[model samples]
Target chain A: MTTYYLEYLKLKKKLRSWLGPIIVFILIMVAYPLTVEFLEKDLEKGFYSLLWISILLSMMFSTEDIFLEDFNDGTLEQIIISSSSFPFMIAKKIFIYWIMIGLPISALSFLFSLGITKDLNLSLFVIFLAMISSYIFLNLFVFGSALSLNKGSVLGALITMPIALPVLIVLGKSIIALQFGINYLELLLLLLGCLSIIISTVPFIVSYVIKAHLE
Target chain B: MWGLFFTPEDFVQGNSYRIIYLHVPASFLSQSLYAAMAIASVIYLVWRVKLAAYLIISIAPIGAIVTFIALFSGSVWGIPTWGTWWQWDARITSTLILFIMYLGLISLHASFSNYEKADKLLSWLVIVGFVNIPIIKKSVDWWSTLHQSASITLTDKPSIDPSMLYPLIGSIIGFFGLIICLVILSSYVQILKRESTKSWLKDYV
Candidate 1:
């Protein structure tokens, strides 16, 4: 418990790490309408695609240095020496990131969806989808960040982005489901199922990856 | 060789259908090679088999080339059959994703100069990226894509005629044998390069 709090405070101090993604998300959402005409329908047409991609890009940006700071400072090495389970710390770190970064992006996605599509019900559903997907993306990108710990984040993004493509496909389908009022729950449940698997496995795998880096 | 002259041409696709002999084996081997790499990765990660690590990188380039062949031949086959080269169908798109993944694995390994660290990271990436395999396999069934579902299966009677099926089976076996030989050769190079410092390698070479 104290570890989670401490990690939370630690991340809270790194303002750029948490706040940058939200600002980027806002910039993307705000900038997108300019490229299209003044028509509301035209704006709605590209909104979800832009929304999901912005969320993906934002998550990737946010995790670019998830482990780098600690790694350079020998904090990770110390954590490994301590008796605490490394994977648990990783999961908690990701959870705090979700609270700090993902939750806000998801909420903003809801606001963006509501503003553009003018559909409150659909916007409400977008919130849930965004929240689940952002968490999933955060976990995957954190794994990427771990893989390319000393190397730049671009290599990490290159390798991890393909794995996330399927999730993007699912997110696109979920939006269609929302628009049509069919099987939306099933799709949401599918995302949840994926989140369950990823959330459980990534931290453990990342521990080994970080260990490889340390070695 | 027998698939070229012996098998009768399809009435629908005519001569263009002959490309199937090349396309099927390449596509089949592409996925199979990744599956093999994934298994090797598992072995390496779990048991720390140095040979398994060698096998993973050895198989990556061959897998990429084979995947590219599958995509190119599929495009050629599609032009005549579907009246277009690419349709972004599930199978084709997933296979393209597979090709990119092969490149990604190779690049990830190359980015790190340390071979051992590279091997460990590459293995984990291979294992994680294995999720795309089943998606490629079942894409036609999972979605109403332009690509057709499998005509051949172990569980059911083969939908293809005996004449075409036999030659295709022969060609797939021949192609797979050739790929295995290539993989063996590649592994030899990997072992030679990575193990140059070891005394046993000097004796073996």
Candidate 2:
């Protein structure tokens, strides 16, 4: 609880970190319409694909300095020696990032969906889909961020991008299923299951990875 | 050459199917080598065996080359049989992902100067990436794909004719033998480079 609040406050101080991804998301959303020649229906067609990719890119950017700050300040070493469970701290840190960056991106996904598709039900579903998918991407890129701690996030993002491609495939399929009046819930449930597994394991793996870096 | 030139052409596809001899073996070895690396990763992580670590790095480039051959040859075979070079089918896409993984593994290791840290990180990535292997194996069954399912299975009788089947098995074994030699040669180079500062390595070389 204390750790959670501390992480939240610490991240809260860094306005650029959280606000930057939202701006990136907004830019990507706003830019898509300009790139297309003012075709409303065509803009609708490609909106969700751009939405998902933009969220992924923003999440990648958000985590670019996730561990680097603490690592550079020797704070990570202090936490490691503090007798606290290191993985728990890492997991809590990811949760705060989700609250800050991922939550807003998901909310914007709803507005963009409604603005473009103008379908209330589909936009609502987009909100839920974006919420879960964004969290999953956050956890994944955090793991990537941990792996390439000293190296820049590009290498980290490059290596983990393949793992995230399947999630994008699922997101594409789910949207199609929803449009066709099919059972998209199964796909949503699949993402939920995937999120559960990744949430439990990534922090544990990342703790060891960061420890390896410090060694 | 025996499998390519001498084997009887299929009744339907004819001479175009000859590439199967190379494609099947390369495809088989590509997946097989990753399974081997995953096992080596497990061994290295659990037992901390330096040789297991060495094997993982040694197998990575060879795996990448073989996976490329599999993709290229599979593409060549696709032109005649599937009427296109690529279809984004599950098997093909997953194999392409596998090829990317090999390169990712190699590059990930190269980014780090510390060999020990690189090996540990590589082992974890290999294990996580192993989830794709079973998907690639069962992709045809899982999805309605254009690619064919395995004609050869350990428990089931072979669906292919004996004449084609025999040479296919022979070529797979032949490829396996060739890959083993490459792994040995690669491992030797890995050992020499990693252990270059050691007195034993100096004397042995």
Candidate 3:
């Protein structure tokens, strides 16, 4: 358990290096959404734009180096062969990466859409939407990282986008529905369903990919 | 072939509906090709069969192009009928995402470039991607059924008239045949390229 906690701390230290990029990326995410305020006057589009920008940017930051640093330093080999289970370590990595990346995006989701989304209550809803999206995206990006982690961030973002699309579609509608004052409880449950499926299925796949690649 | 020429124009869709000839068959190939890739990928992963891995490697682009045709024809049909270039209509969006997946697969395949680990990694992607197909199909149905309130939305109609039905079935069969032939031919070329150094090449080439 100390090893797990120690591993978590190492992940935190690795993640701290990402803080500079995360803040810069978050700034771009915030500014880009507001820039679209004039181009698209619809409140829903505004919220959607902000949501996707944060996701895309955060994914780039989170996934690009998710595995590359470890692989380069050869720590990945040690992690794989350790007495600790590999998936446990990967799950922990993903959890910390989400905290460093997703939290800020979700937090700033509303501030980014100040003039566009308009209502404070709905902006809070945007925060909720952003959180679920980032959770789903972090997993998708983690999966993508396993594939192209040695490649650049551009490919990392590219590979993750398609697997991430369903959530984007499902949540886009749910958030749009929320904006219209419609009850989106059903859609929220559907999003939760997607999150659970990704959570359950992707880690195993990631572990397999890493093992296959590393071996 | 008969379906393409002999089918009569419809009262509503007229000539525009004919794109269904391409659309339905392409859609059929989309699902079947993915099924093939998934099966081949599973065989390769479990048994470590090189041929199965090569089959997936060879088949990904063909499947991706076939998916593109379905999306294009569907989009063409939609423009006149749905009065929009793109509709977030569940089926269209879901298929577009599938097409994106195919593109991603192709991109991933290109990056590895015959590395020893390439086959295994690609196989995992194929198997993982197959999970999305049924989910996308069902999610579309569920979303539409929940929202439509009335059971009979224009898009949810259960039956097609015979004139449309027979040709669609014919076109689907025809397209399937074409894809099979194409895959076989491509597999032959793939084998030749991959196995060119083998002394067995003297037997045929």
TM-scores of all candidate predictions against the true structure:
0.97, 0.95, 0.85
Candidate 1: TM of chain A?
0.98
Q: Model 1: per-residue lDDT, tens digit, B7-99?
A: 898977898888889999999999999999999999999999999999999999999999999999999999989999999888999999999
lDDT of 3 by residue, B33-144 (tens): 8889999999998888878987887888898899999888877888887776677766666677788778887788778765447777778777867766875556656676
lDDT of 2 by residue, B103-203 (tens): 98999999999999999989988887887788789888977899999999999999999999999999999999999999999999999999999999878
- lDDT for predicted candidate 2 compared with the true structure: 0.91
* Candidate 1 docking class: medium
Off by over 4 Å in 2: none
Supply candidate 3's per-residue lDDT for B75: 76
- Model 3: CA > 4 A from native: A1-17, A32-45, A110-121, B83-88, B135-158, B197-205
Per-model lDDT: 0.93, 0.91, 0.74
The 10-residue segment of model 2 chain B with minimum total lDDT is: B127-136
Please provide, for model 3 over A118-140, each residue's C-alpha lDDT reduced to its tens digit, 9 standing for 90 to 100: 67877777777778888888887
- Better-scoring candidate (TM-score), 2 or 3: 2
Residue B146 in candidate 1 has what lDDT? 93
Spell out the clash pairs found in candidate 2: none
